[model samples]
Target: MTLLSMYFLAGVLAVSALAVDFAYLLSARNQLQVAADAAAHAALYYREQHDAEDAKVKAVAIANHSMPEDSYGAVLRAEDIEFGHWDYDSQTFTVDDFSKDAVRVRPGRTETRGNPVAAHLFAILNKPMWDMTAQAVFVVFDPHCLREGFVGDKVVDIQSNNGYEKGFCVHSNQYVSVNSNNTFEAGTVVSMPDSDEIELPRSGFESNAGLQAALRNGYYRLRILNQMDRIYEDLYWASGDFLPDYIASAVPITVSQKKLTNADLIPERVHRVNCGGQALQIEAGTLLHRVVVVTDCAIRFGAGVILDEAVIITQSTDAKSINSASDLQIGRDDACADGGGAQIITYGGLEVPAALKFFGGQVIAKGNVSFSADAGGIEGASVIAGGTISGTSNMTMGYCGTGMDDNFTVPYFRLAF
Candidate 1:
């Protein structure tokens, strides 16, 4: 009986030792995985602006910070950081040094780096040590609705006879309300947080069969709106160099008295026009090209005013920060083509009453945007508003996949794997 008791004690000791070794191995692997995840995220974030080498350096530092070299023994190397593109369909990462979309990181403790986790009692089972490698892939993505469309934080109300072209999108964080006789072309999307929350006519779904496609889950938050102040500061300071060519006026620049012509903008493509809380109205038949007008007052585009390759910025919070009459052209070329596009960035709302032909350009507002004119030449033009988008009718808007770099884009990072 005493010899049997001794044998039972020996079995219990062996089991306890195995448990300790398994727990230690798991803890080490978890630590390595945490370091890899953090490093991948850091690398992708820095890669947005820096080169590949700089990104890799940042990743290695992050990994080391999480798991010190003394403890982990150089778990991460600069070469272990790879720049790549994460394909959603194939769930694969293709290495590309030029692409800044994704980053892959490998952090590990292994025999190769002389950091293999030594085992205690597992050596009795011919397992002297354990090796672990943790890999992480981080990617940046942009929502399609924000790229080229009419996106509103509040309601998006459109009247009848309006035709949205292919690739065009309209999304509202709250809800989207539309009247009948509107055409939503194939490949066009109108999305809200909830499809049942969309306000439409009685035959809304039947009339617009494409409305079914609009029933997508989740709402896209406009992160760019929060960064507008920073964006404004950058544009404002960059215009300081060409201050001498500013519109020389303390009062408003109106058509009745002081009208502005192309001659007012000279030598440079950017200019600062401070109206001292007054209005800045361009004269009729004036053609401004490749110029940026930064002002603190409201802006008015006179009849037949062609703003080709131009940008108008207003810092006013007035109800109508930007207004235009009939025959106001914003771009000079095709919507999908590059170059010769105009943009209007307003702190308040934008109101275009009639015959506003805009192409290959973008209108971004901190307030509501009302376009009552026909949507001729609206392809490649994005109308984004912080508030509601109403008073629109008989307009057609299409998406321009390329040549829209000027459009405000907010990129977000996610762990793909």
Candidate 2:
């Protein structure tokens, strides 16, 4: 062949070799990216359960699937070309030791290089291999969604189990109106804010006219229609007994006069505190130093958890202070001595197991406060015996404050994932 013809042929061959190498690199890069993406998605599924091991296995499996394979001889064949040293596990070039053709699949990150293709005419020019690399990162997916309201209807239901009547004392700055037609029985008391003209269900009251007149004149009526509607919707979601099985099965609870020395005042598993006996479970516990704070905890009563001190406060704010005359604060007190600030005083729910005898003190329920027992038989923390829970024409119950109101906010659940 002529010298000029030879040179031309060599140039054409080199160009073709470059094209093949470039195509293989591109294909390999695409595959690597796909593998990385799939691996990341799979890792997210086990992020909360398995962590790193699960993620690594899933990534390798995905990478293997992305590569092309053949049967029998199992040669790396693609585009009518036979490639050598395509070791996926090592992700390195088989032909050239220093070649850029390699894939490194690591936990969290995967790196890959294009296939190794020998140059035809370029081989004479000392060009043996073309190298290409791609990298991909894995991340967990996160999304935010808000949940609100109670799980079901009937936020509060007062029933007579042993021929005893029940009642509630609802105190609120807003108007109180019953929306249900359920009977208030013969001795139910409903209170409200103002003595204004109000309507009542005929079946709920024998003295419908008297009840309306009292409500109009700011006299908290003994019976209001559908009073359960005024309760915060979240109150219904709380888990625990509103009344204890028996009044005498309560355990005594004591608080020291000095500040609490430990972060965990009660056992971790003690989710509920029941006082169901004649004696008050929580007696004359002094708050001379920092106040007793119950956090991430529950104070349940059997039937007779009495409060020796009427000055007890259930403070809901982070500062932990009594806001009103009837307010009682529970949870950690950051201001108290030796306050580690480690105490988690946030309770998801609160239940009154039985009639709570409160001499004084505010019951501040940061979460939901449920009262499902009969009103007349037992004297609850707020309700008196046979007094009939009388509220003004506009009495309110449940969490009535602003910002994430009880009716609008739902309890947060601890998901496994």
Candidate 3:
């Protein structure tokens, strides 16, 4: 009877040990999974800033510190890191040397026989260890680039007197008002939250509040602009992710910005910059690779003003004037001519010609983007207004993908499933 009791006690002790060891293994796995997630995101961010080789180096470095030195009882090595694409259809990760969009990482590589979680009491029964693993995948996307052609928080009014070309997409969170005299080209989309309220000129609404997630959330891991004015500061640095190709891909301009005091820049200069976010006059037929930042000031355009390879940012908080009005004034109605497009951003209200044409740059304002007269609207341009885009007549916005090295795109990163 005493021998039987001893055997029962031994069996109970072994079972308890096994349970304790299993808990430890689970904790280790959770730790590894967290490390891999952080590492994968860091790798993708690095890839955008630098080359692929530098990206891999950064991924491994971040993974090594995510878990404690003895958390998993093994140091993370470079072999565990992988550069690849996350397949949407197969729900798998595929290795690729030239992969740019996605990154994959495995902190505790337990696929092989040797890299297993060492067991405690289970080992006494010849079940010495068990395999444990965790992995993470991350992908990169440009929020500003990979989205609808026209986006408005309140209302998206497509009251063009002319017609919409193919491949045009318009989105609004609140409402979409399509006034009269508008023709919907084949494959044009008008997305809004309340699909029933959508006013279509010819056909039915092609898209709806699918963009609600993007509008409400900033999911990208890097280069996000929460405020409307943040876009201006980012133009100075490539890390901010909105620098035009003209400046980023150029041979490093000795000067990126110039200071101007309500005076027009000389058009003939090759690459002159206007800094200090001061107000300036962009005369008609002005051509140069320059950057203009306007702060707490107003900008007037002499009729027929043209900006080539240029950036214009207006930063005004609340109201710059005593009368509660925006300090920025764009172009006059009769005196209008433009080409080679410009990048424009304003924190206050903006007033422009009713009929406009821009060869593709960014135009964002905190206040209303109103028109002066009925005219042919924008072509190859992105117009974003915090308030209403009040205008009528014909307008054509051809989505020009990264044209003339002057294209600017906002980027972000996040875990992809």
Predictions in order: lDDT = 0.78, 0.29, 0.55
Question: Tens digits of per-residue lDDT for model 1 on 1-417?
Answer: 999999999999899989988998998889899999999999998887688999999999999999989987999999899998989899999999998899899887889998988887899999888889999999998777877787899999876778777788888899988888777778888888987888989887777656677556558767777766765765566532222232233232322223467777642344667777678878788888766667777888898888776777778988799998887787775646776667788989989888777667778899999876556657676778899998467666666787666555657788999
Residue 157 error, candidate 1, Å: 1.9
RMSD of each: 5.6, 21.0, 8.3
Residue 327 C-alpha lDDT in model 1: 78
Q: lDDT score, residue 155, model 2?
A: 21
Write the residue-wise lDDT of candidate 2 on 1-417 in tens digits. Answer: 699999999889878877876676566556545654554344333333343444445545554465433211111111111112335466443432222222123221112223443335446567665443333333221111111111111121222212211332322223333433233323333333452422333444342322332222222221111222222111122212221111222332344322222242332112122223211123223221222232211222222222221112222222212111112222222222221111111213334433321211223333334433323222222321111222112111121111111111112211120
Top of the candidates by TM-score: 1
List, in order, the clash count of every candidate structure.
Answer: 0, 58, 16
- Which ranges in model 1 have alpha carbons more than 4 Å from their true place? 1-35, 49-79, 82-99, 112-124, 239-259, 333-335, 408-410, 414-417
What would you estimate as the lDDT of candidate 2? 0.29
- Per-residue lDDT over 217-256 for candidate 3, one digit per residue giving the tens place of the 0 to 100 score: 1112212224444555555333255654345332223333
Kindly report which residue stretches of model 2 are placed more than 4 angstroms away from their true locations once superposed.
1-20, 44-47, 68-104, 107-265, 270-417
Of candidates 2 and 1, the better by TM-score: 1
Candidate 1 lowest-lDDT run of ten: 239-248
Q: Estimate the TM-score of every prediction.
A: 0.78, 0.27, 0.59
